[model samples]
Target chain A: MKIKGKTWKFGSNVNTDDIIPARYLNTIDEKELAKHCMESLDINFSKNVKRGDIIVADENFGCGSSREHAPIAIKGCGVSAVVAKSFARIFLRNSINIGLPLIEIEQTDKIKNGDEIEIDFENGILTNLSNNQSFHFSKYPEFLQNIIKNGGLMKWTAKKYIK
Target chain B: MTITEKILANHCGQKEVVPGQFIEADVDLVLANDITGPIAIEEFEKIGAKKIFSPEKIVLVPDHFTPCKDIKSAELVKILRNFARKYGVRFYEIGKVGIEHALLPEEGLTLPGQLIIGADSHTCTYGAIGAFSTGVGSTDAAAAMISGKVWLKIPSTIRFIYYGKLNKYVGGKDLILWTIGKIGVDGALYKSMEFTGETIKTLPMDDRFTMCNMAIEAGAKNGIIEPDEITFSYFKNTLNNNIQNLKSDSDAKYEKTIEIDVSKIQPQVSAPHLPSNAKDVGEYKNVKIDQVVIGSCTNGRLSDLKKAAEILKGKKVNSQVRCIIIPATQKIYKQAVDEGLFDIFLESGCVIGPPTCGPCLGGHMGVLGKGETAISTTNRNFIGRMGDTKSFVYLANPEVAAASAIKGEICHPEEIK
Candidate 1:
């Protein structure tokens, strides 16, 4: 699987609160959460984020709070993928469980906001469409790959237990 | 194996488990708060789970957005109320509810050597009692609720030893803040933090809970202190059966070991936007504060309230400061009232709120306005954590928070005179 999108750059330690503040956590509706996604960093984020856009960040892209709303809001806001120098542990688990693709780039200095990039999920390659530079990340384990492909843990567990 | 490894292996029925191994582990307890409970319940239904795996093993505490911040939060809580009723899970209603992390151990629902999972990050707070508890997302929580098992990654262990005696005013909150300042926020990412040494050996259970609660602040999967006589004594009144003494083997492998000297340390206060941005309290004495919040999963226990009351026993809260104190549970609140701590708080111009996680996550009850600054005992001082984005939060222990409230600025406890 491959994804291509324009990048929205963020700095290190973009916490769960910044991704989606606690005030908006009253509802389980993904769209309601999406409407306020990343508003702390950019007030107009959800309004301006185009469909299939990607997010790139420095390090520890999702830190603070174990609320899965952070990833759900990101996904709901029309983000195709996220590339970061590193991901927080809980955030990584939540994103995979929610079927959101995350990539790790050692140094994100070269990736600029509004720069277009393409990701090859199977091959673990991220190509900067603007500069044509390619970087490689470690591929997910087979089990995790299947879980994400099956569209998160709920459906995956349902396939095995719901029958 | 380390303590964390031993607990995980035992739960998964594995003879041995190493770092980076994925195993399906059984949970002794599963926890969720109102905010995450609704989402987990929704996913639980989507997966068509008929009955809960173990009704007795599940815990629901509606503390986060509790006391009904608004109609939206009330609706969200109704979902948790319904789910708990349907499953017969242990649910703490509004009056009976405390912070989930504090309430569980207080009620002896979480014990040593158990593998517990929760949908809230602070669930790692249970590690103080030697349990292997960690936080997961809502979907994972829903799955665990159905099967009483979930996937776990055996993380490497980072051992921290604090040898020196703590200063009079310094406590677990100070020690943990100093440790986080020494090691950046992500230093322990995906690692288990094993706290040991003479300082921890005699530390009270409340302070131990305070330290373990902030393990996630340093990005640790869990923070634990091996169960000893102190731990056993805390449980002596609650359980008839003896808790086994659990500790890491001498030959256990650790990712790294750090030694901290609390004797030489002073009270610390973390600055805005990051818990790692810590500084000695004296540096910020000139920075006046608007409010002081003295409760949460981190430091809302009896000892914390007593300490806050001790400093504010006779002195009044500053005219410029609004001090809000909350006991973590109804039992604690009643104890405080019985002990006259409530009179001390009331006479000092402080208002006591119900046992809710109010204002900690900017939920409500004492939300800060623009340009306001507060010294809070609750964890997390991220931008806009306690209020508007322009508001600032300084993280400190309850004593420091109380003194700051009396002085209307960031002042050390000793400076109150």
Candidate 2:
């Protein structure tokens, strides 16, 4: 699977609260959540973000709450994928379970905000279109990769257990 | 193997399990709150499962936005209530419900050697009871509800051993904040923080719960303490006689070991944005506070209320500060009222409320305004955690919060007197 998108960069330790504030936690509607994604950190986020945009950030992305709303909001906003130096454990699992792809790379300084990048999940390579440079990331374990391939844990579980 | 590993292996039906190895383990209890429950129930329905694996083992508490903050939140709770009624799941309603973390253990839902999962991050609080409990996402929780099982990767264990005795005003909140300060927020990512030592044994169950409750702030999968006599006594009346005490093996492997002397520690606080950004309370004495909240899953127990009441028995809160006290559970609220803690709070210009998570997650009740500053006993002082992004939150124990309320600034308990 390959994902191509423009980047929306964030700094380190961007917590879930920053991704989707608690005030908007009143509903489980993905559209409502998407409208407020990153609203607190960057008010222009929802208004400006386009479909197939990618969020790139430094370490500890999605820290703090275990609310899956953070990932739901990100995916609902039509963001294709998220690339960060690291992730809070629950957010990582939440994203995977929801079928939102997440990539972890060591050096993200070269990728600036608004840079067009393409990620090759099959090959574990991230290419920055603006710089014409490529970086490699470690592949997810075979089982997790399979789950991602199936779109999410829900789909995978339904296939494995329901029928 | 360590205690965490032992419990995981037992639940996974394996002879042994190593760190970083993913295994499917049978869940003893699954927890979900109002904010996460609706989504989890949706996911569970999508799986086309007729009924939950075991209705009795599923616990749902609507504490985050309880009393229905708005129409949207009310609608969300309505969905959860319908699902609970349809499936006969154990659901705690308002007034009876408290913070999920505090209510679960107090009701004996958490026990030693049990494998537990919750949709809320603070689910690690159950580890204080010697249970192998961790937080998971809503989808994971939904899967667990349907199958009574979820997949998890065994985490490496980090051993934290404390010695000596805690000084006045220093408590579990300080210890955890200090630990997080020493190790950055992500220092223990995907790791089990196995807390041990003579100091921990002497600490009350409330303190133990407080310590384990904030483990997530340090990026730990769980924070656990081996069941000792204190633990046994706490559960004696609640648990069955067949309860087993689990402990780490003498030769248990640990990725790292940290030792701290409680005698030398000071009352600490975590500044805004990150829990790892901690400092001694004395260092921030001049930081004036606009509000002081002494409740939440972190420090909303009876013992915490007693500590705060003791500090505010005669004095009143500073005119500039608004103090709010919320008990974690209804039982705790009754106990505080019976013990005259409520009177003390009222006399000290504090507002006492029901057993709701109110304001902890900035849900409702007492959210801060723009540029406002609050000193709270709740965990996580992340940006806009309790209100506006311009507002600041200082995380501390109940004692520090109560004292700060009287002075309208961050200070030690002794400073108030």
**Candidate 1 i-RMS:** 1.1
Residue pairs in clash, model 1 = none
lDDT over C-alpha atoms for residue B185 of model 1:
86
DockQ of each: 0.77, 0.80
DockQ value for model 1: 0.77
Error of 2 at A14 (Å): 0.7
Please list the C-alpha lDDT of all candidates, in the order they appear: 0.91, 0.91
* Docking quality tier of model 1: medium
Clashing pairs in 2: none
Leading candidate by DockQ:
2
User: Candidate 2 - CAPRI tier?
Assistant: high
